[model samples]
Each structure stands twice: as structure tokens, then as C-alpha cells.
Target: MPTSTSTSTSTSTSTALLRLRRQLLSTAYGNMDFRYQLLASLADRALAELDRHSSPEAEELADSHLRPEYIGITEGRALSEAGSLGIDTSGWEERRERIRSYTRGADAVTPDGTPADSAQRLWASLFDNYPSVAAALADLLTGLPPSWRMDLFQTNDLTQVPAEPRQQGDNGPETAPYSSTDWEDCAACMEANDLCRFHSGFLAGEQHLRGLLATLATDSIALEQLQDRNHEIGQRQARESAEKSPERETSQ
Candidate 1:
């Protein structure tokens, strides 16, 4: 069997993700951002698929995760597997039973378990609390170019997308020189122009570029917010530790 290497999405959301990954990876030292985008992309794909169609079995699988106790375990596993890779699913299969309960709506009102507040909740717990989530992100980002860390908050650059224009003429007013023979009475000068690679005008859309910029601004702001909160989490944890254990308290 031949090994395959390709990256493409079956849907527009996938396309957006592909572009996002490319944009972030275009910069230097971008591992965290790259991993985050990749994880988000994967989550988007799953959510899209779920919203479209699912087997009863799959529905059961989704429901199995809602128990307060199991919510922590299953959602954690889901995040680690996706953003972190499958590195932390040691107890994943077992957690699914609880998730199934949630999917079946068994825990809707009881509110005993740490059921997923939303899919975002799953990501937060896994990345912030689950040991594997950050590890997975770290691994996924390993050895990648710094440029891959693009977000709406930073620059979103473009790479060449291969393309060629089809022409109906050879030597006539519109034909590329390759088709000069097909043009019948077309001029040789026109044919030569068509054959010259330099003469080919590359195509891109101004509106598309504008849209990309807008998205970049949005992403950048979000990224900065994340960074701020992450910094705060460390401080918050330190403060809590000081309050909980007097021995650990700082002079401040």
C-alpha cells in the first residue's frame, strides 16, 4: 500500500481550518497557537458531522457523557484525544458509559455530575486541568515552524494556491500560444505571449483579502484574551494555595 500525505477538508469549515493552520504556521515559534487551531478545527469537524447526521448508537455515545462524575472524565478524554492526541485516554472507554447516560438525557435535571456545560467546557478542562490536553497540544506543535501559530489576533498571510486559466484561442485574440495551431489564422506574436509564463496574470480577490484581515483581527483579540486569562490562572492558583496552606504563603 502507498503511504498518503494530503491535507484537505470535505467541508467549508474544514477549508477555514486549513487556511487557519496555514496562516498561523506561517510565523515563527507558533506551536501553542498551531495546536489550538488544529484542535479547534477537529472539534468543529466533529460538531458539524454530529449536527448533520448520526446513528442511534452514536447518539447514545454522545449521551453517555453527561454524568457529573463522568463529565470530568469523558470530556477530558475527548479533549486530550483531539487537541492532545490519544495520550490520556487511560480510562476513556469506561468514561463513555457516563457520557451515554448524559446523551440519553438521564442526568438532565439531577445535576450531580460535572456534565459538559458546552463543548468549550470540555476543551477548557482538558487543556487547563487534564494533564494530556497541554501535552497533546505540545506534541502536535512539536517540530513545526513558528509561523504555524497564526490566530485572528496575529497576521494571516496567504500562500500560493496552484491554478491555471483555460483559454479558447490559440493565436487569435484570446488563445494561448500552445494552441496556435488550433487558432487557424491567429498571429504568432499573440501565440508567443500565451506561451510565456511571465505574461500569466496571477489571480486573487481583494474582498477575500479584506475578509481574511477581519478574521485575523478577531482571532488576535481572542488569542490575547486567552493569554491574559492563562496568566491570571497561574496567579489565581498561587493565591488559592497561599490561603489553603499557610506554610506556602509568600511574604507579600
Candidate 2:
């Protein structure tokens, strides 16, 4: 026989869990969008670099920048870039079409039987491809409130049992547990998480591009110096041969 108080507590927990699930879903989707924009900005910058100083090495770097293993992450940005560059994009189009068909099909779970939620899929795709980004997201998770973390674990079936309800006191309804200050702390943590993820992702992309550009610039400079040195040596050899030709004529 469950008391009304216990029943009410269970109901409250259920409601909180539902709210938290929605929040998680929303956050995951938002993060996916944020990552896509970051990648797209990087792709655009690479393309601009190619347009300004087109070289085989630069083009290859741009290709690598645009071509991530997870096609959905870029959403045809690579295909569009390939077409603009007059490269064959038929293979990419075909792959995208196949994915579209599969998404439209009746499969509700992944090959491993995990539920195929779009937000979760995109989140996993990004994190799996970008370890730094994964670290940033993990930091965000670490910043969550302990109670919220526990709720998340329970929601995901990671916990074997529900958390025990706080003991009621002589006072009424336990004063609602979470204070306004706690909520402000959660909000602050979320803000910090966003900033951390953005900065980390930006720095990663910038470093990759800068390193590629530097290497290409160095190679170009080295080639030019070699060509100049070879030209100077050829001229010296020609002048020496001309001087010896006059001496040979006089001897004859």
C-alpha cells in the first residue's frame, strides 16, 4: 500500500524526468546545429583560400576540410564545393541519396539496436569524428547539477534504482528542494559550456588551416630558392665555357 505522499513524490520525479529529457534533446540538437555552423564556416574559409591561391596542396587541404567521414555533418557542402571546383561529385550525390533512402525506410534502430534518434545520431557522429569537440561536450556534461546528473543516469537506464526522495520535515513540502540560486548556477554553467565548445572548435579549425597554409608557403619558398640557385650556377658555367672558347681559338 503506497501512501499518497509516496505517490506524489513518484509523480513529481516522473515529471522532472520528462522535462529533463526534453531539455537534453533540445540541447543535443542545438549543439549539432552549432557544430554544423562551425564546420561550414571552416569550409567556407578553406574555399576562399583556394580561390585566392589555388594550388594542388591547397586544394587537397580544402578537400580534407570539407570531406568529413560523417556526410550528414556537412549536409552536401562537400558535394557543392566539388561541383564548383569542376570535380566529379556523382559519387557523393549517390552516397547522399542512399542515406536519404535509408532514412526514409522503416528502420528505427541502428545496426547495434540503439534507437535512431536524429539528435543522438548527429551528436554521436560529430563527437566520434572530432575528439576535441567530444571533450568540450563532456565538459558540459560534467557541469550539470548532481541531481540533474542522477536524473539523466536514471533516464538512460544506467542506474538500477530510482533516487530516494528527500525526507519530509516538520516544514511543508521540503521547500521545493532547488532554490533560485541553484537555477542561476545551472544557467551560468550552460553559458560557460557554450563558450568552451565554441572556442575549442574554432581553435581546432584555425590551427589546422594555419598549419596547412604554412607548410605550403614553406614548400613554395624552398622551390623558388632552389630554382634561383640552379639558374645562377648555369650562368656561371656558361661564362666559364665562353672564356675557354677564346683561349682554344688562339691555341688553334
Candidate 3:
């Protein structure tokens, strides 16, 4: 495990790591919760638009955000661990070197003299430092504190989108930075028609992935057909460009 000289700071690091340790069993759940929180933030904007009559789509938007599911576990145990790098009573950028030495991966290395595997292992260790990750693992065959605090991510981008309700209009959905689902239908349709999926989903069946598929299949613009049309459009553009060229530009 990583070390913190500041015994006072140890609690904070331990608390943070316990959070990530929990996630070992709840990666899916964490991602799902993260998505909804994002949606709720967007809804707040729509809700504020009372004076402008509301959009039918916006209500659907609000409804979608309210729906909730749980984040599942990340699975497996971490062979190593990390704690918060205790900063001196004073904080400064150059002190990062001191902190690096304490991370779970600080001394990890391969016989070939590379830290690649150990480095990745370190990432899994760091994520465990979050309450969300810890909560996900609470039910696993792992140990967790009885009085654990939930760790949540806060982002200005979440509710901080610029199109405050008053600012929204046909500037299109682009005005709002958008939570994942805010423009889900539009984005899904775009994805479907684009065929980025069919490549086969690795983590495809989970809620968010399922949700994306549901949207693309049910409401997304016709992707397969669109693909064909896009090909045609490209051909047309090429033909047009060719016809307008000043020289035969060679049949090369």
C-alpha cells in the first residue's frame, strides 16, 4: 500500500481508497449513477424554462433523468493498494515527487525492467480510493467499514451548462453541453446510422449500453440506409468536384 507520513492525512487517504476498493465490485453501477446525475443536472435547466411553455421532448428529457438504477461492482481484488500522498502542512506543485513515491505502484517493476503491468495494477488501486467504488464492493466477499460514506463525482459541466433555461431555443441541443442522455435519442440515431456499434459490444448488455441500443434501434435515424445514402452523397460530392475541376486532373 502507499504510505502517508502525515498520520492525520492517512485517514483521508484510507477513506478515499476504501471508496475505490468498493468499486472493485461496482463499476457498472458507478457509471450508471454518474450518467443519471448528469441527466438530472440537465433537467434542472429545462425545469427553469417555465415562462417559455415547455418542450414535449424536454418533459421526456426530465422524466428520463429521474429514472435510476444502481452501479454494479468492478469485480476482483486489488493485489496492491494506495493512499493519499500526504502533503506537508504546506501544499506546493514540486512536492508531487514525494507523493509519487508513496503510490501503490511506486516500486512495481518487471524483470525486464519495465513497470507496465505494475502501472496498470496501480490504476485499479487508485480507483478503489473512491467511496462509490467501495460501495459497489460492499456486498462482495470483501471487508468494508460499517459507516462508509458514499463518494460521488461533482463536475461544473454537470449542471454548469451555459444554456441556462432562459438561454435555450432552436440554437438546437448544442446550446446545452448535455448530460449523456440529454441528446441521447439524437446521438443514438446518429450512431446507429453511422454503424459504430455492430462491431460487437464488449460490455454491451449493461444498462447504459442497453439504453443506447434501445434508442438507436427504436428512434435513431435509419443508420444502414443512411450509410448507403452517405456513400451516395460522398460519390455525388466526388463527381461534382470532378466535373468542376479546371483540368481533366488525370484519370489517375
Candidate 4:
């Protein structure tokens, strides 16, 4: 049998790996937002300088400020961060370059007809061509804490989803029953298995993820898809509940 110390170390390694994946995804998402804001800031400076002086020197300075290399630098930093986590981003270079090219071309636009930032444009393209990636992004963002939520980029560009009431109980509101099970399992695992060191607050953290997912449902299609998934889960739960209480159903 494995010693308790070895089991704990194994659990710790597993937990670290899980957290690293989440961190990498969050960093990627946040980097796009950061890149957009950085570009916008440069543009704002260029505009202010342009207004102050119409000289060739001022124009050159403004143009230099918005150069693609600056964007590349920001993305490079993001890549480095991911690499540190053992994520092989070498293959991702092509996608990153495509994003840079699109942003440079000045064609991406938000749904409201405003200029879309690098991240927003990148997200839209990913949604169309690589929806699984986009879905993973949504899943990653949904779990971030409010204070930790990426704010450098504009979320307003996403289709605004009004906060909907979660399925409620007579007391006021309730989370899915599975959430409770997961929460309990997390706790029990941590207690019974020396190797399982999952966070005690993992359940609470899930709320943040859910809120982020709702925010990302930026279109009718996405919203419908999410709703459909939720409906399916609800149906499954209802069936399970019925099976477990067939006597109650018969009495009623």
C-alpha cells in the first residue's frame, strides 16, 4: 500500500495540474482582453497627440504606437506565461499570428457595429471555426472569481444576458442537486483520501463559473444551446428523482 505521504503528494500533484489547466485557459482569455486594452490605450494616445499637432513627427509617433509589433509583444508575454505552466504553445503560434493579422487589418467588429478588439474578434472567429475551444474558454471563465474576472477588455460587446433566477426552492433559491453531490463528494474525498486535496470551497467557486458562462452567451443561438443543455440536465434529474421516490408518486 502507498504511504499516506506519497498519496498526499500524488493528490497535490493532481490538484496542481488541474489548477494549472484552468490558469492557462484563464490567462489566454485575459491576455486577449489585455491586448485589446493595450491597443486602445495606444490609439487614445495617438489621437490625443494627433489633435495636439498635425506635424509629420506627430503622425509618425502615432503610427509607431499602433504597430503590430506592440501587439506581438503583449501576446509573447502571454505565451511565455503559458509555457511556464508546461503548456506547449508552439503549435498555437499560427493561430496567434492569424489573430494578430486580423486585428492589424482592422475588419473585426462587435455586434453593435463598434470596432472589435483583438480578443473579441479572436473569440468570434474561434466560435465559428473551433467551437470546442470557445466552449472550453466559456467553461474556464465561468469559474473565475468576480475580483479575478478579466476586465481589461470590453465584455459589453458580448450579447448581454440578464441575470436569470437559478432554479429556486421555497426558501428562495437553490442550486442544482448535482452541485450538492459534487460539493459533498469533494469534501468527502478530501477527508477520506489523503491524496485528494480539493478545495473546501470548490462548490462556491462554481457559482462564479456559472455567472461567467451566462455572460458569454452573447447571441440567441448560444443562449438557446445553453438553455437546451440545462433543460436536458433538468429532465435527467427529474427522472432520477422520480425513480428514487416511486412510492411517493404512486401515493399522489
Candidate 5:
């Protein structure tokens, strides 16, 4: 038998969870600007939650669970992780630093003392520098997994899967050294790989947050149970003390 208050709280939590899920799904398939906006929003939400439930244990859980993913998305660690998978992420750190400058307000002033690039301009710059970002995202829906791609992307025709990796000295122009198409393909694949890593980190953080929320919810219940047990022990001890006092009075 749940109280009205408890039911309301549960409904509120469910609503928040649904909203977070929708944000994550949109971020997954969104354009660069939309993705960046949602990521920033989600990060702020996580920080707000931490502030709302401030505790040493909560801070520790956030550091262990949420911080890594947040850093990965904001600081280009996802690209670095992809690099560890043998993907070439050359200049990724530099590009990430450029984005960071805008985020940190370092790029907020121009030479003429005018306000610098807006969010849209910054995103446009990123798009120009990394033309394959959108393509890589599209690849995720239309290239990687075959059966679900069509249903998800709503295309009657299947996208042609990329050919197998080329071996050195293979009898094809694609195997030629310094092929521009090869470079583009590599860039697209790396970007896609980075995105996948980012999504994995996001999911991991979400799981941690869910666990932390559950623990916070139970903390008051556990405290109430302990208090009740202690009260019962105190009452029992008082009864025993009174019973013994009567005997002492008779002896006296």
C-alpha cells in the first residue's frame, strides 16, 4: 500500500526517465548541432542531480560512473578510444581543442572587440572541417547492421555495404598509396567508431545514474528501519530495568 506522495514521486521519476531516454535517442541520431546541444543539456542535468542529492557517496558514484562518459563526449576522448582500436585519429585532439575554446568562452571575442562565433557558426566550422561526421552517422543506420537498417532508416533499397579492407599491393586503384578516397573512407569509419564509443559510454553512465537513484531512494527507508529497531530495543531495556527495580525495592 503506497501513499499518495510515494505514488506521485514514482510518477515524477518515471517521467524524468522517459525524458532522458528520448533525449539520448535524439542525440544518437541527431545532427552535429543537435547532438552537441543535447549532450550539454544532459551534462547539466547530471550535475543538477548531483547537487540535488549531494552526499559523499553520491559524489563518489558520479566521479566513478558519470565523469568518464562526460569527459569522453566533451573532450574528444571518444576519438582517442577509437584510435586505440587501430583507427587513425590524427589531429582529433587539435580539433577538439578548437571546440573546447568556444565552449570555455575563450573564443568569445574577435579582434575588433566584437562577439565571436555563435553556436551555429562554430558547428558549421566543425562540419566543414569534418565533412564525414554526418556521413558516418548515416552509415551507422544504413551500413553496419543490415536487417534493422532499412526499417530504421525507412529506405526500400539497401545501401551498398563497403568493400572488405584493402590489402597492400592489391590489384586495384583503391590500394594505391595516398588515395583521397581511402583517406575519406578512413575518416568516415573513424568518426563512426568514435560515435559508437561515445554511445557506449553514455549508456554506461546512464546505468550508473540509475543505480545511484535506486540507492538514494532506499536510504531513507533503511534509516527508518534502523530507528524503529533501536526504539524497540530501548523500550525492552526500560521494561527490564523497571521489572528489576521492583525486586530491589522489596529487598530494601
Candidate 6:
């Protein structure tokens, strides 16, 4: 009897979870911002699970690479990986140096000198000059859940999906290209341009999605404020009614 009850409970829980996932996916279907929320949540939970798998020694090794002394270690590692893959690492050292020159102290100064709130300069440079790297980084980090495998903006034909407007930078190389082909090509063009809507334009598209999410958040805040205002008005009316009730009762 207990085994049967346990099986029934498990089946019920699975059914409920499936229903909830379908509901969320349906809401996220045409809504880009909600899709981002669902994706981000899934990514965060996955990362947390992965983090739990890390041994202390593995974390220590990873942390060691993050130290100031290991400044060029990441580039060296990338070069090693490229060499293993038989990819040409020709000008990578020079490119890395140029990137370093631009990134040095970039985080120290904001135009407004607001150190407390600063932009990630190193990330900005990479995403600006080398969008492919940004795409790889995003894939490594999040690599969307299976549920989000469907094309984000598509009609009856997936190929007919419209690319967002391209916003250029001063440097042509820095400008993310609009990929007409696929998400991989599109992501390669996202070099810090927030106007691109392609999944390939990872960081920029995320930023664009985030802006929309922020607007939604503000709307939610406005709704909460309105509810609070209504609550206050209700309370005041109740108090006034209570205060007048005794006088009316005495008069009667």
C-alpha cells in the first residue's frame, strides 16, 4: 500500500511539474523578456548544481587562475586549446596584448567616476572586438535548457524571422553584424551592440532583453505602489467609518 502511494505521489509531482513547465513556456513563447527570465533562472539553477559538484581542490585551482599573478594565463590556456584543435594561433598573442592595453584600469574609471557602480571593461572589450569569444563564453556559461531550443522570433517559416536593427560602433570590427544565416553567425556579430535580437548576439541580446525586463519590473513596482495606495485609502475610510459609527448610533 505504501509503495503504491509513493508511486502515485511521484506521478502526481511529475505531472504537476510538466504542466507548470508548459504554462511557463507558453507565456514565454512570443514574449522575449519572459523567455530571458526563464532561461536565466534555469541557467542559475544549473550553475548552482554544477558548483556543488566542485571539489575544494578543483575550486582552489580555479581560484588560483583568477589571481593577479596569472594575468596572461587565460590567453595562454586559450592558445593551448587552439593548438590542440589545429587552429592557427598566429596573431593571438599580439591581439591579447592589445586587449590588455585597452582593458588596463578600464574598471577603475567610469566617465562619471562612479566606482561603486562600474561597467565590466574587460568584458566590454572582448564583446566589442571579438564577438565569437563572447558567444563561446555564453555557450560555456548557460547553453540554454532543452525547452528553449525553439526559435525565439519566427512565424510559420523559421527562416523568415526578422533580425533586430543594427547599432554600429566607431570601429567597423567592433560593430556586431546581423547574422541572416543562424544563431551561431548572429552571436558572432553581437560585439556589444544591444540592438541585435539574434540568439547568437548573446551578450547584446541579453542586454536588450534585460532592458525590457527592467521596464516590466518597473511596471510591477507601479502595480505594487497602486495596490499599496488603495490599501491606505481603504484603511483611512475604515477608520473614518469607525469614528462616525458611535455618533450615528447615539443620535439614533
Model 2, residue 230: C-alpha shift (Å): 48
> For model 4, what is the alpha-carbon lDDT of residue 2?
32
lDDT of 1 by residue, 53-84 (tens): 53333234344543355545556556666656
lDDT of 4 by residue, 44-162 (tens): 45544443444334435534545567534576688888999999887788875654453343233322232234345456545644688879999998887675523633353344433
What does candidate 2's lDDT look like per residue over 1-252, in tens digits?
334433443345434322333444455455533444555456445544543453344435434544456334464676677779999876776766654443333234232332334334434434434567768888997898867745756554544555345322111111111223342222212222222233444656977989877776789876677679999999999999999999999999
Per-model C-alpha lDDT, please?
A: 0.42, 0.47, 0.37, 0.47, 0.47, 0.52
* Each candidate: RMSD: 31.6, 27.3, 27.0, 25.2, 24.3, 24.4
Q: What is the lDDT of residue 86 in candidate 1?
A: 40
Model 2, which residues run further than 4 Å from truth? 1-34, 40-81, 104-252
Q: What digit string (tens of lDDT, one per residue) describes model 5 on residues 1-252?
A: 334433443345334433443455566556343345566567646644653454333334444544345534644567667878998778776866654542344234222222122333333434545457645655664665656746655664443543446433221111111222342323222222122233434546877989867875789986677679999999999999999998999999
lDDT of 3 at 107: 32
Which structure among the candidates has the greatest TM-score?
6
Question: C-alpha displacement of 236 in model 2, angstroms?
Answer: 60
Candidate 4's C-alpha runs over 4 A off are: 1-73, 100-108, 114-252
Model 5 ranges with Cα > 4 A deviation = 1-19, 25-76, 94-252
Per-residue error for 220 in candidate 5, Å, reads: 61
Colliding pairs, model 5? none
Ten-residue segment with the worst summed lDDT in candidate 5? 169-178
lDDT-best of 1 and 3:
1
Runs in model 1 deviating more than 4 A are 1-41, 50-55, 74-252
On a 0 to 1 TM-score scale, where does candidate 6 land against the true structure? 0.25
Clashing pairs in 4: 142-209, 143-209, 159-218
The 10-residue segment of model 4 with minimum total lDDT is: 168-177
